[model samples]
Target: MLGTLAAVPVGERPELLAEPVAKAVAGLPGILVAEIDPELADTAAFCEAYASPPEFSANCVVVSGKREGQVRFAACLVLATTRADVNGVVKRRLDVRKASFAPMDLAVELTGMEYGGITPLGLPADWPLLVAPEVAAAEAVVIGSGIRGSKLAVPGALLAGLPGAEVVENLAR
Candidate 1:
């Protein structure tokens, strides 16, 4: 389903992918990485310019909150068609008080991925990957390649099967 773009096999991913994402997905089957113009990296722009539908685009958001007086983080993935249930579902799932979007600086610093390109693949080891059910079911979804210069097309199963990934119902609203 990803034949629309100029993509390389996952094993041949370029350096544009963050070190962690590249390392994690190396040799993984059913993952394709496509280099894109940084100017069209945002979801809407990328979709329109690349002929990918919104339903097949996954947005990765970083959420943070405090649990037991210590900060906790999670990478929440939801289809572009919906929004992550951050205040309700995500906060409850993370078992934290007052969960909110992570500050851009912190997100970039911690994920080692550029803004607009944070992906669950290379998230902090301790951080959980909260995936929306739809995203986990799509045959193929476009996601960040850890940088604004490229994107990744991955099978839903591959994303849901990532270490610490949890596909939750109603995770998106």
Candidate 2:
């Protein structure tokens, strides 16, 4: 059990996951799912209510920047204790003059996820998924399930291995 949450294999509770998340996790090993109060889905409240530590919770942030005229986007995974460095590392990585968190409406529409519960698992295949070294090396980490009512627990290596995923150093600060 992670904190007081009784996590079980994600496949065992498909109803708890968003449609895209349910599809993304199919056949993915070492993934667990647990239900939670929607109102506590934010990192701080979720951690406090579930007795999970910030270091063990990963936050998925969507960042976007325009180069020339085309907008480029990426999803970054960082431990809750630190925030993604959107202005520095992310900007440089995306090769854009400026980078910022994507607007909530855009993020939700593009990712097909709720505002507070976007996860990297089911993001558009074209978007790069950035995984912080610290997060990618953890034994297991908690992440959103594409909806506020549930969360997913999985080995960090699983995230690193996802398609288009890159392990970035100093991604968080």
- lDDT digits (tens) for residues 1-173 of candidate 2: 25899988999999988778888999999999999999999999999998988889999999999999999999999999999999999999999999999999999999998989999888999999999999899999999999999999989999999999999998999
Choose the strongest candidate by lDDT. 2
Candidate with the greatest TM-score versus the true structure: 2
Candidate 2 positional error at 119, Å:
0.4
lDDT of 2: 0.93
Tell me the spans in candidate 2 whose CA falls farther than 4 Å from its real position. none
In the range 1-173, model 1's lDDT, one tens digit per residue, is 34368887867756868888888887788888898899999999888888888888999999999999999889999998899988899999889978999999999999888999988887888889999989888898999988999999899988999989999999999
Model 2 residue-pair collision total: 0
Residue 9 alpha-carbon offset, candidate 1, angstroms: 0.3
| TM-score (C-alpha, index-matched) for candidate 1 | 0.95
**lDDT values of the candidates?**
0.88, 0.93
Question: In terms of TM-score, how similar is model 2 to the real structure?
Answer: 0.98
